[model samples]
Target: MQWGCMDFRLLTFGDLRLVDGKGSIVPFPEKGLLSICFLLTSSSTQKARAELAEFLWGDIPLDKALANLRQTLSRVKNRQDELGIELLLIDQATVSVNVRAFTNDLALLTAVSQTNPHTALEELLQLGRWDFLARTEVIGGSGRMWLRTQRDRIKTQMLTTLRDAISAMSEGADATVIKEAALRLFEAHPEDETVYQILGETYAGEPQLESARHIFESRRKYRWGELPVDPDPQTLSVARRLFERQRSVAPQLREQATPQLEIVPPVPRGPPKLVLLPPVNLASSHQTAVFLSSALLEDITVGLCVLKTVTMVAHYTAEKIALHLDRDAMLERYAINYVLDTRLNFDGSIYWLFAQLIYAGNDEVIWAERFSMEAQNLPRQHREIAQRIVASVASYIERNEFSRDYFERNPEAYRQYLLGQRHLKRLDLPDIRRARKAFQTALKENPYFSPALSGVARTYHLEWLVTAQGDARLLKLAEEEAGKAIATGQDIVGGYHQFGVAKLYQGAFDESIEAFELAETISPHYADVIADYADTLMHASKPGEALEKVERAIKLNPLSPDLYFWTAASANYSLQRYEDASAYIERMADPSQAARLAAASAAMAGDTRKAKALVRKVKETYPDFKIDTWLSIVPLREQWQKDQYREGLRRAGFD
Candidate 1:
């Protein structure tokens, strides 16, 4: 064996480890290892000997701690002969790592994090496996503080690495990189409109137009109650051109391109991917059907965008390429696992739409439906169809992705949650009770499942609303369960939504709005949260703002649930627009709440006969609903709107 040979190495990625060139673990006592790691990771690569001794052995007597430090250094110094390298340099005043003797992982990471992010990608990905000194026993005080600072520094460097990587990819031909970069940047800076502009321009197409418009409109409405507007004139022009091109494209391209189709590629395993193919207009007589189809497709895309477990192609891209190529070839080219196909048939005034979800792997149809509606009711129909499609698709994809072991372990809980969702969709009193039972059953199986907890809370709130009479006990139960939901799922969108609704029913408007705002921030495109927030705003005496939010919700979810229409009616009524309020009230499928609003609107508009008839209809269902109880249940802050509501009800024969 050679004497005075030096071979020092270090590892700081997952854990702190040191070795000689012979690959033998360096002989270090606990204090010595901690001291080495601390000095090695510190930015200055040095620290005062006394300061380190005090930090590491603070609880011991000062002189004793100093003696221990000296003894530890003595042990480390003695090992230098065996290890063939000086790991540390010590003086009476201070100590530091021997930078000239050993190579360090920290140094490598720091240099790469700033200078070459593309090369650092693998290291950045590996950072999660081992936190900085995660296994080390860092108790309270300076040690913990130092560890915290180091962790933060590592995080900052990781983000820097990602940013630099994105910057390097900015000039590449890969749209996927640009899209991912824009998405990551937005995650870091959500309110940056410049990033929004970048994403909008990068994905410029008909689909982008609708999404950009919705984003701009939603932000303006939520902040200032402004009317909806297009994002920009330039984007608007490009979108229109794309839409026209799609409408004018010849239908024979599918056949023409079939002979020239390239070999299909295999889809990679990850999250489920879907492409929503453009709607095929079967009746050709209704040119306006093109706009309606585009609108529905975009609405469905927005609805589905909230799902974390699914990836989707841009609607305009899907619409453009899908029609020109063979379906199998198109799916393969995009690596899509499922395709949503919609066909529209318009004859004179009536429309029939068929939607099907097809599995790309086996060319099997998973779900299909046919919807028939008149031209006047197409908007409402669109919302209904989109909601159903999204629900079905989400359920299908999630169920299919579950592993055998997961299903075997949690089948009952999963089944109960699905049943609860189905019952909740019915939006009736008996169905609400059924949903509560299902959710409770799910909780019994897995008490910590946030979705089940949120479901149970929502069912109680729905019971209070659909029954048209407030039960304080039901509201209390709602609050308890919603609190549990928030506790279990602090960052989940559904928990915040349920919490907001629970607070709204309790007349805690400020708290309700705050919770809803958090949910909206988490899922900005979620129409139900937006609609619920609008209702809270109406009760909080901000009818103008409420109307704006309701309209924006409708824009996002054009075929929204019946509750949205009821909220819209109430908001319009608060604004004293009896005609608009009556129009919206008439759209509600639930007769109990519908009659209450319709009677009030008709009475206010000087239609006594119709108002009295509607009041009789409401009394038939809810004979004990006093104006005071109604007012209490749906509290309003504006004195004038309250007076108007009471007068309307009184004229319609309610006491």
Candidate 2:
């Protein structure tokens, strides 16, 4: 065979598919692909047969792994009497790719990219490939990270080189080249302010200001709200000035309201830590990426928050993790002992969610099974994931009776709480009220529905906390319901979290800690639990310990709610890391906006100007400000902590 004969047709880096020069397709499983990719990329003696066995089947028993490797080699299906062992050479204990055959894309791409970015990129784009699988997610820890770093570096280099080529184009350069480069950049990074700004400016003749501004605004707001300061000056200025003008005319024009604020206990401490990683997007699945991924993460987080053993990472926290698309790193950074990695595949009316578990210590996957249901099974699917996750960690709960104190409530009421969880995001007063009713109903249905009870308590907490929505009566009832929830959930971590919050609101300190500690013990992966628990400690004037829990929480789930980062930033602010605080807050949307508003206000506070402007935009985005009250409905796990948070907002001049 002539050299590089395998290049006539398509080459895949994933499941091995080799089409001979005659267009015959040969199927090669993962082991084969690894072998192929390795062989093609390696120097002759780099691919040892024994090493290949371990690389392909690292998790399997040694004997089984080696056996599989031999079987794979046998399937190469080439018979040779004299050069038989030539195809399977072992020189000095290293295997070699029979350079006598096989051309590979990965090898091809790597080689091409070194000398020809254009051809390499064109081929890469046309190939329409994602990075290799199984190995990316399944390799042992450090090795997996090394592979990721290498891949990332290559991609960054490709894009950088491509951009440099495109930018350095001579006046008569092919329009096709510029167009392709610009189009790819825009597609890959729609949220990059500078990219859009440049495009908008480049096409200024087309009146792209509004579009550019719109993109900037969307990206600006989409940040998880932990900014140390406002966005880029251009962005902050646009949003700030607009808000300032709106605020200037808002006293008598108040038809809208802010979220109600009622103090709950302080953010508590010792909350359990938990982290959720992005589910794999199945290759063949028809599921919509935006809704399912966000919904699944959010729902699971909220549902788990109801349990005491769970220290549920907040929705925003998971969102940050999802954006980065590094599930393995998330597990490591978060120090998560286990991860709930969910995958969805839709076929006809059935939605199959394959939720898999990876134990951090062993990198052992517990099982991979499909939870099949109709599209309508969305809620149930969330439940299924939650239940299975809980079940997987059940042994831990059993060994620690301290953890068991968290889930004695009625399952059905918990389900009602789950329903309310789904509705929380609709953000309409009616929806919020409906959510409240659901929580109420959960209580009515079970009376001991701690989540609902705590949820209601939080509702009241918010009603009293945010100045715009605080109604004393609303606050009182919230407290009343919260008290009931806590009593019912007395044994669960969630119960304590909720109860401690209520107690904190009522200025009950010692009790809040007791509750916070209980919740922390249950769901150790829940970062919000740690954040809130730490806040509680801070409220109780124990910033030292609060700091410690926050550290643990950050470790358990590094992709935090920008708020946790914000909290740390604020602590930095308190500690005078103005630059660091500013940098961190800049990474957030709401906090950045708030910082801008605060800065603008300082420059001018009775200035409802910023408030009105902020409110208008907030209203447009969240027409249901009242529903935000739900956040505080359950009493905080720590009331003093709640007070401190409220105080911080007040100090920041938030109404």
Candidate 3:
């Protein structure tokens, strides 16, 4: 690192440098920079990495300290590069500027900014230039008191600068600087028309007089219009005198104020920010480990994402927070404007959920709700949970996203649908049968429950997967149930997703493709829909296109069901992207499923040992596994395709 001085002290990282008091460059890893900024503003010379990491990455494990450090260090470099400034390094452990090395404007100002008049006033006057980190004030770590304290100091100095500029003008010191300072003062005291009147009076003999009068009159009018009253008599008389002289500057001033006023219009507050915190796996059922987490987040985020003005933080960010940490600090750290956090409890017969949304600024509990749902209605119950949260947030904010009647008039049908959903998740024959009965009951209650209809289709879809007592009968039942669901839910994306799965089950490639394509348009982030589309497209002889859709799906929902990844790997295999196929096949949930896909992908990618090991793993899961027999049981798009894939595995030593 090198430090150079001309107008600023500069430190360079690589080719990049952060100049203290001059230049425009900054490093990447914004959060790291923010962390450093927090440290620098503190009174302590050093802060523990653990404390910093806990604050910044509250949800991340301790092992990620190095990764977080590297990220922050890179940002310091980027910031220096952006500003062409010298960077001061304290390394990663703690960030502080040496009192002897160089004086930082932020440091000097921070001293006086905290108290009435710091003894360093004379020194501060020299260093106080523009608003301290004016551009950066709008961004995050804005939640930190340090930035606010620093900005408060900067503005106070700005006021001092304005006074000095005005003083210099009166003493005939620097006419140009005085005018610039007068404008800045005008900005700071937006409600003060007196400054405008004084400025107009001072510039009366020059060409600037008209411009000054325009400023005076505009402020007077703004105060009057917003307040719906005339200015005070004393202020009005001064402004009236200025306005009379400033007639010529009216048009130019009007042009400037138009866009400025519009830019700051009040923001509409919509549904509260809802962050679905990690649901505890109380039963250790672990079967629903990924499913419960992914599905809950999916429903909540997707539901909240559609609303305008509701600031919902992404699911990944929230779950990253440790459960034991304070919610307020997390909200502040994440810059979350508002939060709707939830928790779940499951007993043998019933599931209960409790949720609340709160404002970060005041810790005000904005909205709260509790739900009790039976095991039989889990799917419908989850959907209701999503809808209730939305409805509650909507009522508080006084805005509507869904149709008002969507759930209000059909409570019974919604309940029955929830029962069906609860049953479908069971993934057993008895559960599927029970789910089918609940779905039928829900449809009987209200025929337009598209989500419940989808649930019924899903029940059939799972029954086929269980490969129960009668293959032909179960497959036919799934097709008919899916058809009934499609009849009701065709216009809804969930309808298409379920129906598409049904068609895929029956090997109806063309129909499945159409259903998934339509579903993808309604909600581009649905992993299941995109994966099914890839499958259908592969079957339709468009493997390349199929692979692209699945890749897009992967990007949209990174932690979707492993089954989705397996489907994508299969698509990649069809497209001869064997390495890419292997990359995705690695994420499969079920050991047996992982083995089959890994064996195929490993063979295609020429990993002989991996292929043999995967085949062995599959045999361990399914002892009756023979390459030919397993291929027959698993549904590949074509028999020849399956034979060719198995042959490649055999050649790679998957006996």
Candidate 4:
């Protein structure tokens, strides 16, 4: 595994880098580095040159791709004499990595995973980041696909190692290691109640009674708060029992400390509960179709969770409840207000998914639709189908819920308000202007409509974001509109939410936080409100709590929008967790939306190459982006926070 007189190491864990004997980074062209990575990580040490060429440059002509591959291989060969190490072996038709001359972190991890998984887990944690080939950006679609596949493979490997280590805990593994592994796993898979159980047990076994109690109590609260309608009965039972045990043990340890654990069931009196049962597969033999149907239903559930007026039962619990033979009794037991029952059937060629909405109170079928799709297109068409279903359901619910206090008295005004909301969610300058027009029309119909007033306020706020201009006039107008909304409808969540956003942008941190808190009080499960509150908290220099709030928001709206990821990334950046910030940015549908933040994070993380590349991209996209101008408008509560961001940007070669 060693070269004659030099040690070469390829690091593929956090970021891809090549280190020489003296631990200095060895620079290579992008293609050369990628070629090396592809060969090193491939199933076989050797690959056809044509395969490597297609992988790296599949978008180009075959002749040009082969030529480019040859040039990249020649470049690598040219470095051998200067570096005194052979890194690749090339022939007329094949390329192979000199596996013995260099060692790679991935290979080392794989080896350790088979031998000592505890060590593998420790190494995975020590990497401080899980992004593989983080700095490498591939140009071709095929290359991007390969990159995604490799990242998933590495993540699965890490999780498997963590699970293996946890399984070995019964064989007298270190308790600390087990706790850390459990925590890491929990971070990656928060929805898995098994991880929570393991974490609570690990703490309890440590005899840290208070910590164990907190863990169990937190689990219980999460189940009640996030999955409010129907939490997994087994998870709730385990958490409650463990919490009581911890409370019982605490008094014995401290003599005078009498801890009390309370298990309060969630009262189903807030928003109406809407449940989407798992789709019933007519062709049970087609398990793949059944899984896709369930996935589509889950997607619809997540999309519906964003609606402020309806509470969605957790998908896991809905699946369990769907199995009950007596559907009416089950609905009554869960206090379900609406049910979306779906059935999947295949008629030889096309798959038909029939969905219906029923009022659980009277067993009335309110709406039904049958969607047809090809079997091959099921996976790719789920998002669109989910969106259609969610939109139809939301429209029906909105029409039926006119009795709520915030609904405009005039039907025309409510129609205009709905139009404004659709435009506002697009989050662009053109849409903002369009939204303003719709809101203005609504105001003409009913001047006292608070929802329309709030919509007007949001248009101004969104304009500010889209323009990236520090326009005090825009903030003033937005705040004024929000104030009117709040004065007209004190109980409505939209007014409070819009007011908080405007106040935050105006640097009124206390007022903004108070407004968002009130909004939460009004609509406790409003995912967008919680996300904006998290953003306010981050700017107010309370990133730890901000992260917690955003995580809670994500739980409420599992398939959240780009803003949630941006808020999470900002919080992580403020906390100096650069890798985590980058990871969150990558989760966004468009990472370029936060390119500046990504650049700063990479710079702070000591990846200057990546930082500079990102800076270049930012400049290409936004030519007028001056760091000082953006910072002035960012509304950071503390000067130190602004300075930290400025420093990172400057280090990343930004103007």
Candidate 5:
């Protein structure tokens, strides 16, 4: 190999792009480009002809594949001469790229290493425009496998580079770079708390305590509703102290400061702590009116607890201290960030209530409202008051934090949540077990955690469904977990949704619909709830309603899981729209799960050969999948609905 000055540059960060010295694109046929890119990115700059042939053309017969490889290689070689670049060093036994002949972006990035991380980071950021071969395609067999491997390798290297850069900053290199790196990590893993900790620590280390405190506070308020154990607790303490000192000093300087207000330090970490003070009875001392005030306070506390994004001091705790001290003293003693104070007045046949959400830190009114209701409507009035307060507090937190509910601050729980979701989404026996374990781990750390508990329940229900179990043990267990989730406030929407699934599978169609309605009321925009609700509707023989709900789910969650499409397909099949059902089934990511459904729909849609092929495929995986066994396990409530499905499968050759 002879070294020569060359103008061509191979950029392989996000995309497979080749730019000449003059920054002009050196276009090559897709085949030739793929061939050159493969060799350029491979180890030792070389690969055997046999290996190349197997990877690039393995889907075809050996002789034809080899001929195709030869043609591609010839085109690649011709491109070198055409562009006046020494792009390849070809031989009878193997082909290699002459690394010294051109400047490659990946090589330049790697050469600098991450020791000079700022430059390396800048390069990495620029290279992130595309994956290994963003717009390129590798059709079938070993070629697709090789492409995946290369893409994963490059992505791994980028992530490693980010970690290295953050490490360099932590070691006292460039503190400013920490923010940029942390934000980038946030972009990559928005739900991950570790990056926010890193960024927070970097700010704290600079004695920029306000920024550090803000990061953690905002993360808690807008993202996680709480953060993980602080990574640098000592540094975090120092930052909190500095913030507290500033708050203390600022209030002292206010000449007109209220003597009744006490300047209390904020909670060091976690979501805002709120306490609903016992309502003051303004009506004449009637036992019933006093009892109603206490009951109202309890009701409000329970409602706030359901919005687990905020911490609510228990009613017992509030009762013991709420009336004994001034609001500021209560804030200081209990470290309460907000106080919900209420006043109740009772006149004949009418109940009047005054309420306000106050910021304990400054005694500022965050929200205030008054309610009047007939004495008989006390229960409804209490619910309305609780809902209003919860919504107001949520909005207040969002306003202070300057973000939507995005990050999951509990790193450990969130990690487990992600792991469990991955396994649950796969919907297999072993994966369901893994998902259960992961969810269990999450609950172990935060026992009252709702999402993890919901996951555990979901996994149990999935296991029961997948195994086609006649025993209701798993279903019962799933129900228990869903109740625990709702009790713990995991996600009001998800908890009800899981509960609905348990009810649906148990053939309690009306109760299941009621649960689903509750979930929909809580989170109207939640796609998973909509999708699952659609599934329940389909089982209840309401195919039209099911179709509408499933379509709404897909619209809400444009990139929803394959199960959403499968539900849509099933709903369409139940509605006897075979052509539409076939179209939706084809869109499913894992069509094998719906193989029987697809085959039936195809047969009814007049695609006999495709239907026959799909039936054969289903038989290969499910040898014992008899129509009678399937019908027995399916949750369809109506005999007519079951018969409709039975006839379709019968048409597709399944007896």
Candidate 6:
């Protein structure tokens, strides 16, 4: 491709391209091109040769990888000379990109975002049209990993920039700009119902009656089926009302109002009411078998109701409804939104229970699963079966309610709790504090709300974790909040789960185990609680059991978080399975979060060079890191466990 440019121009947002001053594309090798992209995008625009080599050719031997990197640099240099531009500044130990010599689209986008966000928003909208590194080929595992991380970072930035721009726009802002921004946001997150509301309001405000009707129509079609040939009067009234509201607000507050001041519909109604019917005896099993299945379903119903996010029909009422001939009539009478139906069958030796959750409005099966156990083992496995069904039903009901904009009792409290959850998941220090505040607000609205109370406890525990301060006060606060949660809502799983985490960090292994056991008894299929329980087990010097629990947690949540892998790695490391530890570390979304453990695992596995590289990374990331101080803060129950980790760090060359 030819470009009319007097200076080197690189584009890294959508594709990797380098155009020379002569308006011609530079013919560079794939590795060389990737190396340039890497250097430019790096935080410091510089990296150690060893680190660069590992990123580019980590699968090969270090010496061979270094040799390959040297050749790549030579090729890049030749291209730079041909273009008469000094693109790279190479030294004996490090490689740095001369960013000032070249103009890149990503650089421009970032600079504009700080100075002129409206312009930046336009650029972001353009860049979001294609994936980052869209045309770049990364062969090495480490290189591909970096590419994934970069893409995620860029996408998050785009969303943030767009939201900020939209928020900053005043009432007098151009309708076209607002429409474009909202449309892009909707396209990026099609599942967010609020985005649809925004789009509809924007179009309505523009007085484009047809377009406004179409936006809401599209959303309705997405959720339910097609509307009638003639639009419902209620739907038309909604659009007209929105237009009137927008025009009224604009004239009064045109100069002072921002997008946030735009009118939003009132919070939706309470959680969906669910009814769990008694299991049908499809196989003419013995009365005892029928009783067993009924008991299991009852337990699941109890568990689901205890979550307090869904309203469950009373057991006696559900049982009476199940016996009625006209099930539709029964469901309608109870105003049920969801129905949990099950059938019990026996194949001589094993009893099988098949369960399904159906949306009552449409009679659609939202989720279905089957469980089988030998007749003799039915009693022992009842809790496990019940927990699985409860978890699945709860998950589907929550998604259903969210998509439909329904909230639990005290909608404001639930909204704040959800906001806190979003911040907590980011796992950054500042966001964690923000999450705590959000949760605190939720508690002020409803002090006895179990989820919000648990959320508050989690923030304190996570703050203590991320800060690495070993602050006893944080643990105490977490413990107190968790205790309040349990006292207010005895059957809720989150209370017990957070209590276990606090106790674990406080070095109360026995108490921690007891709390986790109770949590598992309440909700065995909660993947996060199980994962945290696994971490507690590992710290309590039971690596075998810890590994088993973590593995189960992964099965329950196939897309488990980085913390799950970190726990698995720690357990494997304690069991002297160094290779397994390293493998688990590799699965983490950001291995740097557990760099010390990764380094130790590598050293124990006899990969001294790799271990030392990770050690250097740790030092670079945390300049004042001391092995003794870190180990002292780590809550390892056994002295030998601490000794083993210290020895691994020592061998990894950590001071």
Best by lDDT: 4
lDDT at position 176, candidate 3: 51
Per-residue CA lDDT of candidate 4, range 1-655, in tens?
Answer: 3346337777775567888777778775567668788777666778899878877875566799899888888888887766777778788899888878877677766666667777777766765555677667776434554565566566567667766665555544346765676666555545445555555544543434665566556655654453214344445555566656655665457565332322233334455778888775555587655655665565445445445446876565576677778878877776778888888878886777787888888878877877654433433344444444444444222111122333425656755665675566468789899989988998998888887898899999888888866788998788778767765665566777887899899997866887787777555666788899999999998999999999888765555677899999999999999999999999998999999999999999999999999999999988888899889778898888899999999999998
Query: What TM-score would each prediction reach against the true structure?
Result: 0.45, 0.42, 0.46, 0.46, 0.39, 0.42
Any residue pairs clashing in model 5, and if so which?
A: 14-130, 14-131, 224-409, 450-490
Q: Write the per-residue lDDT of candidate 2 for residues 71-162, one digit (tens) a residue.
A: 76665534322222233444444566555555545655566566655555565555444344323333321122224333444446545655
* Model 1 clashing-pair count: 1
Ten-residue stretch with the least lDDT total in model 5: 398-407
lDDT (CA) per prediction: 0.63, 0.51, 0.55, 0.71, 0.66, 0.70
The true-versus-predicted C-alpha distance at residue 467 of model 3, in Å, is 0.6
User: Positional deviation of 365 in candidate 1, in angstroms?
Assistant: 12
RMSD per candidate (Å) reads: 20.0, 25.8, 23.8, 25.3, 21.6, 19.8
Candidate 1 per-residue lDDT, tens place, 346-369, comes to 666667777888888998898888
Regions more than 4 Å wrong, model 5: 1-415
Off by over 4 Å in 4: 1-310, 313-355, 358-402, 405-408
Candidate 6 wrongly placed segments (more than 4 Å): 1-409
* TM-score head-to-head 2 vs 3, winner: 3
Compared with the true structure, what per-residue lDDT tens digits does model 3 show for residues 1-655? Answer: 4444444432211122234444655334445445545556655655565656544543335458546756666666676566554333545575553434433445554565554332233444444344444444222111222344444445556566445434433332335544554465456556434454444434433333556666766765665453222344444555565455446555666455321100111233433444566554355564343344444454456444434334444454455542535766766655555666666666666566666766667878877766664333444545555565554453222122132244344656655655565566557789888988877887787776766667777777787787633365666555555545544433355666776776676675655665675566444444556777887776666777877887766544444556667777777777678888887766665536666766877887788888888777777767765676656555557666776677666766555
- Residue 241 lDDT, candidate 3, scale 0-100: 52
Candidate 6: 10-residue stretch with minimal lDDT: 397-406
Sorted on TM-score, best first, the list reads 3, 4, 1, 2, 6, 5
Order of the predicted models by lDDT, top scorer first: 4, 6, 5, 1, 3, 2
